[model samples]
Target chain A: MTNSNSFPAIDQDGYLLSRTDWNPAIARQLAQAEHIELTANHWEIIELVQEFYREFELSPASRALVRYTQQKLGNDKGRSIYLMGLFAPHPALLVSKIAGLPRPANCF
Target chain B: MKSLLCISRHSPYGTAIAREALEAVLAAAAFEQNIALLLMDDGVWQLKDQQQPIAGIQKSLARNLNALEMFGVDTVYAHQPSAQKRGLNTAELCIESIEWLDDDQVRQLISNHDHLLSF
Candidate 1:
């Protein structure tokens, strides 16, 4: 049975399922690949992703994601670079991964 | 086909970067291109919940963001770390929930997009 409240769903066979479920270990690995030091901000991003999944039922694109956060938090803390810094320190890749959408088609 | 990505890293009230970013995105969307917007660092401020602009400010970005959907520019991303740094949590803001991408992912996003414009 699928638990609507849970982030990852399970099938009758008891297998975990999700579009992109990153465990803490996996998250850590990805963070290491990006040379980002795990911090409260990174965790906040993860938490927001989980929340977004619950509200939208789908991973949001980059643009929508920022707007969403800004709405939730006040402007004092929602700047693009600060948000970008949490994921990797680089601005572009941060948007791609968080949105769970394909990388922008023309950044290169 | 032409694609445009506008990056906003400033707040709504201070300076015009956020407002300009919104204008650029709206303009690109009007062109009927695939347009995406990203907010990292201070840019996340553009999405804050309720902003009352002082009388002297030229314009406000809070209104502009609310109209992104009208312009067909939907994709929005924000940095989680930056939000926390500023003591702004999700519930406190007014915009939609943005996806949080790390640095590596940001690089990939830039590479994939056809055009990139930052304000």
Candidate 2:
């Protein structure tokens, strides 16, 4: 089933309506909610961050995200400023939500 | 408004301790509380320029630091010795808004606050 216009139930923040019901389409919609267009780079970071959660069972905060990104994506793409621009407003929160994962612990 | 001093004494990137503390500060400010954020010891590292936490799959802690001022948290402080220990000066700090404090001033700062919260 595709989400037509109605998004699933998310918390006050635009996270996930149903954690398990995540599809690529849902991520696009979620990004739309934040007014961000998911570019190729955006998808790369989002997917990698989600993979981080799967591997570690925890959402990587800003610090962890940078290190992991550097390792997998290379040093250039791992910059904090670049990530901030992509996930503007709230990077960890938006990235986690876009990736169909829960909020990172210890994130403000 | 209650006077609150929040001491952030953790390294900037290892964990979310500093960010969590910053959230607490922002929340306090939203409630119209008089809040002061202090970065001391290793926490001073949070203010270093050229931080790149995103590659680690995290967000920038510096952005939260910048947001504190907008929340009316104008009284920000960093330990002088802590900054110096890392060979850092105010110019090298990500936040130039914060004042540097010495031991005596730190003591006075503690007394000035009605409640002191450590992060």
Candidate 3:
């Protein structure tokens, strides 16, 4: 199963082969396949995720994301529902996809 | 992976909690658990930058923290009040970029983890 629009080559699980390969175009294409329209909130999470990887050298899992977001973005934007709204069902998976981060290790 | 928070409440050297908590964290990370390490109370002393080896009693505590990052334990934190009580500052910590949290944030950190282990 592949997208009609060519995406920058990703791994079998939809993770980018190289972090440098990610950009806005790649993010938009990924979100489109997930039936999502990228909003400001989506981009916020995406940005935070990349920064997290840079700082921690690992993708933030769901619970870690909630804590980090709560500290940085405030309580309203940090809960599971807010993340689920932007990237439903599997917020960690979807957020990492859009952020061009590696699939969060524990996401599956 | 289960989110495991290892809370170290005792300082290094005096007791085994420092090394014990670190060992548990390493084990959890080896299991591919999402692990967070929080230094509270006397535990904040573990992050103090320079410590000479305690004769033959203990290995360098700094080495343990560095090993933690390599072991895949990414979220290292220190409780603010705890550090302040001990007159410690984040800038002088052995681990680079350790998150400093107040009591409220510490409570939130606790709630974020699936498992809590205290040492």
Off by over 4 Å in 1: A1-108, B55-58
**Which sections of candidate 3 miss by over 4 Å?**
A1-6, B1-92, B96-119
Of candidate 1 chain A, the 10-residue stretch with the lowest lDDT total is A99-108
DockQ values per model: 0.02, 0.04, 0.02
Per-residue CA lDDT of model 2 for B1-119, tens digit only, reads: 66899999998778889988987886676566788998899999889987766654786777667656545578789899888888876787677678889988988998998999899
Candidate 2 local lDDT, A1-108, one digit each (tens): 645676677767666745677889989988898899999989999889877765544566666676678778888877778789899977877899888887765567
- What interface RMSD does each of the candidate structures achieve? 10.3, 11.9, 7.8
TM-score for all predictions? 0.49, 0.56, 0.53
If ranked by lDDT, best first, what sequence of candidates would result? 3, 2, 1
How far off is model 3, as Cα RMSD? 10.9
Error of 1 at A47 (Å): 41
Please, what are the lDDT tens digits per residue for candidate 3 over residues B7-119? 99998888777988877876677567788999999999998987776644566777657646545677789899988887796678777778889999999999998999989
Q: At residue B108, what lDDT does model 2 achieve?
A: 92
- Tens-place lDDT per residue, model 1, A1-108, is 445444444333222343355466545554565677678777776666556544433333455556666667657545666676676454434433433423322232
Between candidates 1 and 2, the one scoring higher on TM-score is: 2
lDDT at residue A68 of model 3 (Cα atoms): 68
Please name the candidate that would achieve the greatest DockQ relative to the true structure: 2
Best candidate (score: TM-score):
2
The better-scoring model by lDDT among 1 and 3 is 3
